[model samples]
Target: MKNIVNKTFELFSELEHCNNDQQKWKIEEMDGIMREMSEDELNSVLSARMLNKICQMIEEKKMSMENAILLLKCIGYCTMLKRIRVYCFNDSLVNKRFKTLIVDEYKKKEKKNEKLLVDFCECYISLSIYFPSGLLSVCVPCLQKVAFQKEENEEAQNEVEMALMALSNVKNSEVKKELSLNEITDIIEYHQEHHNLTHLAYQSAWQFLIFRFNMERSLEEVIVNELHFVREAARELEELRECVDWKRREKKKGEKEMKEVLIIGRWLDVIVHFFLSCQLWNEEFFGLIGGIESAFQKAKGEHRGICKECISSFTNIERNRAVTIEDLLKGRAVDAVVKEFQTQTLNNEMTYECLTFLMRVLRRLKEEKDEMGEEKINTIKKKLFEKMEEEGHEDIAISFYEILHFFKRRYDNGLSLDISDYFVNVRENG
Candidate 1:
């Protein structure tokens, strides 16, 4: 096996300088050797050696860039090796296998070859189809390294983006085996943290859920606590946006800042999708709805848009019992529901459901005048006014205004109108 590996590398080395005919003969001979080896033997011996040579070609300063890319692609196709992952390349008198090779080397002031790294990332993502853990072991660390880099410069940002794209590809691909719950928790924690809002690594976001694991029952407890992480991300973004333009805050900032908002959005988006897939939102999970509510309260601009989408996925009742307006107000679920109209983002059906809930709350507030809920009632009033102010606002907004008018009509003269007059006035005014 060692002789065959040496002989194969030597033939390729000569073919680099030989004429076209010699190159064809070398490739044909290499194909014969590959055909002779069993899959298990190739996996154990030949495949690993070929992968090492490919990495060597990448680092060898004497080799051409075109040659390295072509040779790697040839190795991928020729052996059709699915299991072996290359660990080391350079001989820097070291023991680490792939030290800093995952990222492009910072050569002097400029970066080393970037295309080579991208091609390698893409190749590994492809290999992930057969061996999920193999690709993940390599990509996860690189994803973390790039995601947390502190440099604010464009080059640093691009490296982060490249890492995300690579991980996203792996996460996006269909896989056969699911990762264990313990394995997924760290990834979930990383993306959900407030630290990520400033420059979120969108790539690390989806790898956890790519296979749609049966983790709902196993992971529910941790998931409940992890939700607050998304809430903090919103708070961080709100602070950042507020700091950026303290004077005229309504004027949205540059696209770069908006992308920062989206980083949080992307993380929350994955969490929502993963949680819903678990199909295991017990009462405990429902209680943590406050985290999402807090997120809704501070969320603004694009952040609010993301929160609005997140709300639709989490409407659950403990049993056959209905989720009353009182419960929502106490838990601040009203804030999340009201975001749909304040942002004018939800479709007509969801908008109507939200409006119906608010109308019930508004009517109850007018009749009962609960001093305990005074602050919440006031907030609802202000949000309703804001919805009315928005242009092209839907009928749901009008229905809300009519509900307010109905309540006004009932007690305007201290002699409350009868039920019949209430309906009559609402239709006429509406």
Candidate 2:
């Protein structure tokens, strides 16, 4: 069995020489060996010998770019290679050798193929590397390459997908271990640098790490760090979106490039959503709402039009729903966010979206009537109505009146005349 495995490695080496005859014969021999060895033995032989040979060729500079990539594919397709990747990543010598191979390949390429080279580089960095030192500088060029590359080769694409999956699994395991915020940050930074991964990737990786480590880092720490990461990522994505190449891609596919940008944008949205919802749930992370809101405000200011629109919409929906929940317990009104939402009007098509926000806020206020007290609630309602009137939201005013009437009938009896008259008058005047 050992001899047969040796022969198989020898055959693979010969295939590198472009000798078709030898390749065929070697494959035939490999087939017979596979038939003889049990699954365990096959795995052992592949990990011990076959994988080592591939690494050796890379170390010896005997592997071609094409062959090295093909070898990666072969390994990826093999069940044993998955385990081997984990083991090899843990090994300093093996990991260094892999990095060297990828860097060398990148250096040999001309400018025209640089993007392709960078994809390979990202793949190399993403596979086994982890935190502050994983691949930050390395990822920049690789990201540039991904942006530059007009099309993706199968291996490059597959490698990225696989890398994400592996990181996700690692994160899950780390969460069980209960790692610290700094530790989670390290993992995120590592993935960001090496894989040139997006914020979502970082978030996913962090979530998994938290689960894997089973650490008890405060939710505040988690949210703050995540928001910081997202903010930076969003800025970078915005710049990338402005690039001529990226714009060209956008024109070609409308939102294809935008979708890629959204990879980061969506994570930012999640952080905002989580923080606001946390406020209502009375989660410890609620404290970060101020910071999160500031971040969103800055983001909205810096990026007007579509980017601002999407994020603002997200904030509106989250804040409205958050304020309504009874169990989550609302804090002091975020006058700034409310003012911002009111100031940003939508077209007729977006009226419903706007209505949704108003409805959520009203519903929450009604549900928590006892906690908020009649006097404070009425003050808030009056303020909201005045703001709506100022903004010419007659429709909103009318809807509020209807809602007030319903509540007045159900809870306050006919004594809710003030609310009913205000809305009814607004409807009539409009």
Candidate 3:
């Protein structure tokens, strides 16, 4: 490796001032040497030497950007060579110098060509690197472009995914905190569509939002408002749930469809995981619970249980949903939620959750001044209790009395109501 590096340098220096004929011969010799060198295993020193030279040539304008990109494909792109990229990319001096070329060859050219965009993004991953606060600015613009790409090309999209995946790697780095962006919303709005690279793209977008939230103040509006996302997430879940029976149909015909069904089930689980994995400060992200409720309503049997898992997550203290009990009855929304409860009343677990949120929402509504809101709450309370009693759910029916009192002013934070008889009544009736 040392000998080859010395010889390659001598030849490179000669080619810099050689006559045209001599230059041509020197170029051929250099290419031959590079090919030979690449054929051997690349250690950190050799790889850094090549990247250092590439960086120097491009910086000095001695090499055309086009040829530089090609030369990278010839040498820097070796799968085997990448194993040592970890070592080479860690050298801060070399990494810093390569930034200029990355900007010139990749950042500037990303939108003009998908192939370059992919290559650029892959460079982030292929290059095991740190993104100290200011050092990562060069890649930020191109990262946005990669996320919102409209093309359906698999490689291009996969590369976009790779670009996002690279961001995840730096999330724990020393300077990791926030990534400020001028076009954060644009990237998000353009990418509501599901990507070919699902988790990669999803986490990439989510992490960006997370970073911006931590780094940038006054971004609460963007971070919390994603009703469309809720709708699409629920829609995709129901679509996957709808396909569950297809496996049985295929089995009846002896077509062995369980494998395909299993894949769809996994995707449903993916959606579940996507929502469940999110960490956010709880706010009234209106329509989200409604969307989840809608997903729960459409699912059946085993699928319904899966949907319930997601609902149960949102109800927990750590993962509490953005939607509040108040958002439930804001408009005609209460109608659909109540109608569904009426239909699913026989589903004991579903009925219990529905009633819990319903009572809490009614109390929230009662605190509001709108007469219609008050009337709406009374109507909901009447319908809710009647169903609980009609279905003989004594515990759920009686619990509403205490849950609603939670909305009223407390007296010494002690027993405001005579619950001694309430539990006894519930026990006797239930």
Candidate 4:
């Protein structure tokens, strides 16, 4: 690690004296060093002083397109580390300097720098994860300008995709400030009318838009009551069903089918994200339960996990009037979660969601003294305990015990379960 630190400083010194052509190579060399860094090495390098040095270099150097991308890739990688995320969150200059760089590059009227724009989007998305509030207020407008600008070129399409993804990462406060209702309406209509963008691009745009409606309380009524949005969701569900059927029938998906599955998975994500924030669930919307279940059953890998996570959300709806434990049970929520635990290796997020759903169910059932719920609880307990015995899951086991302890004490005291008690552990992945 000391050797790695020395090498990094050496590259920085070389960058200072290097010519533009040589600078590119130096940055590339820097990228390689950062790429090979261990977690501790990354943490070491991502200090305030190092960030200041990086900002100075970015300001001083007339970096080539490739060099700028290389530098940003290194920065992007650092932003992904858990410790570095905490560091970035506490540091305001990192956000401001990078946002200015992205905006300045964006405002340049020469031929568009497509790779730089995408990297800017990627880096900004990473920053937004830690600085969710005001970080994107200025940057998002620039992304929106390019994202909504009509251009029928490959460069335009890729930038639009990245920009939409960046917008999706914007916080609710910034989202409300940056995006207007008319602009939001335009995005929905524009994507519906245009097919020039790839499925991923359109899905990202939708994800961004839905996230806005979900986060901004003012738009909740618009999303829930809007007939057009419901129609679009219905249409997307039909397409999702077709994809689910294809996955069921095909033994080995070719490249095209794999792409199609991924696209469909993104759409599933959009729908789930939308409903996850819905304040109420009407009958017509709830009728789509069958489709959600079928997709969960047939979809593979992460997509299937996404479906299960979505189904898990059904039981825990905080504001929805029509969502009952009985409704969730009938929709086969318990069965889907149980099957997942029995058959699949659950990720942290999925494990938490599934456990949250069951805990809620058990709490409700215990209050009502429902015998069937008792049977279901016994089955889920068996599966979870069996899972606890596996290796590399000490964190999960700890969470399991915490949840059990919470319930035992709550039941003894005749107190209701508070979901907030366990909410902090959801980001345990970090």
Which of the numbered candidates is closest to the native, going by highest lDDT? 4
- Superposition error at 124 for model 3 (Å): 8.6
Deviation from truth (RMSD, Å), model 1: 17.6
Worst 10 residues of 2 by lDDT: 421-430
lDDT of 1 by residue, 1-430 (tens): 3666566667766754655555556666765554344345445444444555545544654344445444444443323222233332222211122334443332324655545555555445423333345445545554445545556577776565545444543433333333334444454565455344224443243434333334244454454345443344335444444434322242345544444444444555554555544444344333445545654555534343545544543343211123333445455565556556554433334444444444544455465447546566555555544543443334445444545434445434222223221121111121
**lDDT, candidates in the order shown:** 0.44, 0.43, 0.46, 0.56
Q: Which should have the higher TM-score, number 1 or number 4? A: 4
Give me the displacement of residue 46 in model 4, in angstroms: 7.1
Runs of candidate 2 with Cα error greater than 4 angstroms are 1-175, 178-185, 188-260, 272-349, 396-430
Candidate 4 or 3, higher TM-score? 4
Q: After superposition, how far is residue 95 of candidate 1 from its true place, in Å?
A: 34
- Model 2 clashing-pair count: 27
Instruction: Give Cα distance to truth, residue 384, candidate 2, Å.
Output: 1.8
Off by over 4 Å in 1: 1-119, 122-161, 168-198, 202-217, 225-252, 278-327, 335-430
User: How accurate locally is residue 74 in candidate 3, as Cα lDDT from 0 to 100?
Assistant: 33
Off by over 4 Å in 3: 1-145, 148-150, 165-180, 191-207, 214-217, 220-287, 297-300, 303-305, 313-326, 329-376, 396-430
lDDT of 4 by residue, 1-430 (tens): 4588678777777775777888878777776666556557766766666555556666776444456555655565443322134354336454566666666776788976755665765665644455444445545665677678688788788667656655655434445534445565577677778756665556666666776775577766666665355456556656645754453444354434554555555565566566667766565554455456656666645454446545554444522434555555455555566455444233344554555555565454444435556555555444433433342233443445545545445435322345433222111122
Q: What ordering of candidates by TM-score runs from best to worst? A: 4, 3, 1, 2
